[model samples]
Target: MPSKMIVSAASALCLAATLLPAHAQVPTVRIPEAVADWYNAGDKFVQESQKQKVNERKAKNVILFIGDGMGVSTVTAARILEGQMKGKPGEENRLSFETFPNLALSKTYSADQQTSDSAPTMTAMVTGYKAREGQLSVNHTTARGECNADTIARNSVKTILEYAAEAGKATGVVSTARLTHATPAATYSHTSVRDWEADANMPTTSVAGYPCRNAPGAVKDIARQLIEVSPAVRSSLKVAIGGGRTYFLPSVKNGANFFDPEYPTTRGRRADGRDLTQEWVATRGPGAAYAWNKAQFDAINPETTTHLLGLFEPSHVQFEADKAADRAGEPTLTEMTTKALQMLEKERGGYFLHVEGGRIDHAHHNGNAKRALIETVEFSNAIRKAIEMTDPEETLIIVSADHSHTFTIAGYPARGNDILGISKGVPQRDGDGQISDVDSNGLPYTTLGYQNGPGYRAGGRPMLTDAITTQLDFLQEAAIPLGSETHAGEDVAIYAKGPKAHLVRGSMEQNWIFHVMREAFGFN
Candidate 1:
């Protein structure tokens, strides 16, 4: 049997909503789940469930937001935190897009792995193909890191973004991570290895440059491919933004590219003397612009510019919590999303934009749930802003997670308990009399936790007060002590609104998301 703590803690956490509120002003945690509503036999639930059954004609434009590792648990906890911060009864509150007309759950399993990673998850979302782990835009038959020409030619699947572009729709990608990271790269490039961001990151022999020794035409380092990529039927993207400035610069014999305005400590990763940024700028032609700072980026007239390339950091952009303090003045994810939409919307045919809150996964990997929650909060803000900028009638907005993490909202924290705080104030029934059930370690535990991570505290000896437990830097206790927490195999929720939104009602495979977009847009 599992440890009593595991089973008991889970049951107590599930039952926590029935307990009193720790903070008197706020209400108890509402059972937002479907089970309670089903039992209640409420008319509202029935009416809400029945709505959005008819899928409308294809949308003119599509905007998909992928919140990496944003599991249902993360969403629930973040929902509470967002509400509590605003002085509301957290459990009853809703994020901006949570009220979206349609909702469904996505089963996030890859073709080759029970638990998925960003690469294959993104591939599934964009291509409607369940790819193997670490493969982007390639089918399951292709082996990871295989640079064989025949395999590459046979397995590369066409993505929805490419489909939109081929149909004469404008296309753009924005992220808060290196533009070449797995999530964003899946939209534009096909590669077996997720780590090949630049030439320096690729192998000199097997992983050798774009058009590898074995794969003469397909396999290539991500950044090189990004700069050289041209859609098969349409012109290249109208806009691209995010970090990885040094990856585009040529190699320096000594010292880093501190001289580069946007990336001071960023060393050039390309051994070749090619300036890919300038080359990309050249391809964009007369009205094109390349920006490395806020001023340069802001100066670009969105109306006139046909294409804009921005690389603010030498690597991934700072997390949302630290973005405001960026020394190089990087754009926020919302800023990039807004700008890309402003430019792409001007096109006559329509647009497809992929915006990723890419750092949520990063924060979770480091066992920092607070940062992950805040990142999710920021991502919610981005969705609201996108809704404000676009037309619902013509645009299809879908918000979903690439995969989930091993995070949990456990422990019997009282109603409206600080989402980041320890469980307290709930008295559980013990045999004949009630007792403030304390653990063997004689300490109260937390409401939030991880299945396994660096946050593990051996023996669970150290008890925590609300003051320390609620701190932003506090780490939720974990069951195991891995350097990093791993992704979970779970069903992530899909929240959608506007055009073809009705099609997203039932639980479906991860690749079903891409097909929904295609069917909504009436793409063959």
Candidate 2:
């Protein structure tokens, strides 16, 4: 392709990005080199498809990876960023799960709303039943924030993890978010409010409007529910890992909380004077152990340990970009997933494990595109690690997202341009009158930005140079200032491989995921 044509294509892309909706796909650069690379990619996919002639079979184990809020744009940007990190042209790169033989798009709308929250979307994925926003395992028949225990109990949908455990299979849940957060908690807990992760976050006294206020021992916070297994299931989980340690601990007498001088929000939320971690270790008996840091987590012996409960932070785990700066030194998502897999490997009846890249959503909500992208790369790495350890013949692996964000990758740049860098191809003129990277406003802009978020600039967008836009602490520019980026109402991608993976095909309802997993394991 001629340089003039390439510049024109780039300019068109820039114009479209500046004008189109945030959910619109990034325009492509279909130059000869790009076209050749795509052809090679297509050929590779064709070859892989030709070789995978395995028949449909039942899965002995199931692993579900949730990249919370990871939509198409996040994946594309992450792929490019990962490629750039490895010193290559990023556009051609593919994350590990992208190679999964079967792929589908998940319609992530909740039963009550088009733009759903994590509680409903994740509950739908695990339970095969659509739920209302903020309700954990309960069906949409239940109201959000309702404290009606009878209604909640009657309407609660049994999750695939519960079914797996009932059949005597080992079960586990891992995430970068708190263990009691929406995604992980939906696997086992039945609650009408996703925010009721700790006692402090719950209503202390019963009001006339609430249903369970007068009942004895009828309601428990999400954190308590995770530690207190129901008598109906096996409850012999091999792994329960993540953050939210503060939610499990009681506040100190002096009113000081779990003191993390580094992270200001690392304060205890449990006002009931209960230490759930200790209770968990005690309930699991001799072989079970509790870990609060990376050193303790690393010392765990999966062969002998019947259960491993790791809480590395007061709240959500640090973003992958800030992992090194965390003095607490929590385990990475990959580390947690591998450890859980090893422990579950000791089970004779197979296992059901849910691993979440939960921090991706948090970063997006904060309008910190760099952390979200970094979190995605780490999530991809964890998926790749799991693929390496599990066999396709017996284990079913899936990678999916609950919903998308208003996050976008716009602003045309030349091939091999830095994904996090300011818009360098916004069309400037050199001394020779040739177009360059600078924008029309004589300012640089980030290649990645959000539709609305905390990063919005009141006066026109600033010319953030690479030095600022590319930093780990940088927040991408937003179209509005809402303090947080809103979730997008578009469908998210789901990829699957291994036994019965072919079931994930075309466009499907989010709740259909539970049916696919059930079919994969022959759980029903």
Candidate 3:
């Protein structure tokens, strides 16, 4: 039989099966043997549902995985791409966290905005309170650019990491983004403006800006908070690994600008003349070490290193698709997660670790779905590594996104279709099943698209080809033109497993995640 006829026949068979009663007599039909195979396979899934059980014991360790801008559609596309890479029909594949028993939908709005930014969304997750957009950990009552250290202290809410550290658990923060970026910084730093990452980024004269110098070190930038401001962070943050080398180092060293070790052309960002990386190592005394490149990171022995600070790049780390091209070489998200687990596990007391696949959002913003999906796949690999390294009984693993992107998956592509290629599927009603889908302008459209982004063409859509669509640098089509893609206001998914993971069930506000984590840790 022709392939198109087979697909139509299969569709008719599925429709008939749905319409007929269990005992209804039907005309004799020649069904493939795989029908019985699928029936038995599906029955096993029904049996597995009966085995679901809840773990009520308190958790000893907690690991939070945030896939920035990772939405349901992104997960679906990445799962298919992952399976396709493994030589299978992509629909049946699952990301690592997708296998978690308890999952929920998180409404990701902030106190002031519907489509929120990472700063407030992350603050919600870490502090159990939703703040206005651009604010970190501080409550909504505070001004957007408040530079007063005392005012921030008065309005600041404690994060779960701080609680864990205060209770004697080791703490760590890891990300593919700058360590001072909103998502990772929310775990340790509080600020009114997310952009104030370094002393140089702060304003000089405004009443609400750059007053930290006159406040006698009362208020500091996000990078300084990681090293000198936060009590829990400075004293107990055992592992800090990610990019943003310039955020910690001073622009001046020995009376001249201090150049980045990895990027010689770029100097450090701090104007205060303090190298926070040096401070990070000095304050921790004997067991502390700082690494600027892969060689140094590889040499640090997790067992003997009580404190670790690794900054691989001056800004955000390379996307998974571009990591090989990085000058100084960078660690994969999985490698960082493995090293973090190895180091945090050394303390007899349990630990709290925050790992962000921060570059997924960056890729999406650039309208590059290929890199975004690849980053998500790497994020999944890191989650799998964490699961393999920790005991599920004592480790509460929660995976979620701070917010979702406008990235979308559309059209009815065939089961084994290339996720990044033009949409092609068996014809159902009026169209030919064998041809790629076309827009009103007669241009072939890919299955993947964006609501608005750099991919938008002003006049008409471009004719897409397999070679063009499959390239790593290709940007998918967008409906509306914008320099950068904006985030979607829709809710994101939450996947959890281990002690008290049952609390993650049902729809909830994004901030509820913090409460669940706190409860799992047995904090009063």
Candidate 4:
């Protein structure tokens, strides 16, 4: 055969093999070197697909991972960024949860609003019901900031965490945001107003601009609910770790307020003369532990500690990019997750754990795509670690986002282009050796953009250079000017695996996630 004809035959064979379904057998023929890897990758997928069988056995444990504000665009960008960090072309990379066998799209709108907040979306996922925006686990019947305990009790729905504890299973909650923040708070706390995180927050205008004035004990702040009010939290919560430390302590008083353990200049924010951290230890009695810094957190022995509470910051934990600069070190999301799993592993009846990469939402709101993607990568790392630490057969894992940000990834850039940098079209350079792609103003624009955010320039769009847009603090360009970016009324992706994970298939309401979990555990 002619040399050219031999090459053509091999190329054809390679093309046919690469186009076959992942599980299909290929002809026994030599293939070109370039497409050899493609064949191997498909074969691996084939093996994995064959190994995956329907999991119908009741799950003994459950782990719900919420990546706050991680919309579909955020996931695609993060996947690319993570791959690029590993020195790859990036479009082929998948986050840990992306590999889940059962996938679905979750409608994130709340009962009262199309674009939703974390409180209601998370409440929907945990309580099997959509709720009003800004509310916690309670349903839509209760008004926002309703202070009457009787009304709240009637409207409050049981969360999966509560159901697990009632079934004699251990429970845990971990986040990079304040534990009292909407996502993790929905797992255990019930409140009409999410911002009422502490007694000090109750007097704000968002909550009627007055004190709770109901019967003295009719209403309690979110932090207090974690330590004293929530029966599931107080009795069975083996691990509670996150930020928002000041919310648990009282304001400065001769004998009431306590100085922050880590920050010299910061004091507790609570108006009530109560130290909830002390109360957590005292109420749980022996084997209970409290940690405020990385050193203290590292010292906790999960085997000996029956209950653990860790508040790592005065407010939200530092972003992953800035964590090292924290005066008193803070644990990463993966570290917190590892510790929570360790504490819950000993439970005989199994456990239910809620983990939130809460700062992802905050970074997006701030119009900081770099930090948001970094948080998402860290969140993926945490999920990877959880998969490694659990028995897939017994532990059902569900990963999702509460809602989406107005963030977007646009611009027709070539493959392997920097996801965070200005878009460079195919062939990158023009005939005159200038960059090929630019806006009407002849300025380069980022592949990343936001619908509205602080990144908006007051005059006109600024000329974007590679160096400027690639910086860690660079805010992606925005279309509309706003103090902060807003949430979008879009469907978010859901990934699930383990027992009964098949229930997660198809487009579903956000509240359906709770039912899938409930069925996984065979909960009544």
| Candidate whose TM-score is highest | 3
Tens digits of lDDT, candidate 3, 469-492:
999999998889999999999999
lDDT of 4 by residue, 278-313 (tens): 899999979999999899999999899999999999
Error of 3 at 196 (Å): 0.7
* Candidate 2 residue lDDT tens string, 330-443: 899999999999999878889999999999999999999889999999999999999999888899998999999998877677676789986655224222321335557776
How does each model score on TM-score?
Answer: 0.86, 0.88, 0.92, 0.91
Over 1-524, each residue of candidate 1 has an lDDT whose tens digit, in order, gives 22222234345545654574654222234333433433444656666777645547679889999998999998998999898889864886788779888899999999989998999999999999999888889888776666655567677899998898888888898988889999999998887788877767766556333344223444667888787776542264888898878878877644443245654555677766667888887876788789988878888889999889988887778888887787757777878888998898888888889999988998898888889989889899889999999888889999999999999987666567778877654444321322223576677777788998889887654767778877767777888999999999999999998888988888889899999899878898
Off by over 4 Å in 2: 1-41, 206-217, 232-234, 252-267, 426-442
Q: Give the TM-score of candidate 2.
A: 0.88
Selected candidate, larger lDDT, 2 vs 4: 4
Candidate 3 least-lDDT 10 residues: 1-10
Q: Considering lDDT, which of the candidate structures 3 and 4 is the better prediction for this target? A: 3
Candidate 3 residue spans exceeding 4 A from truth: 1-33, 207-218, 427-433
lDDT of 1: 0.80
Best by lDDT: 3
The per-model lDDT (C-alpha) reads 0.80, 0.84, 0.89, 0.88
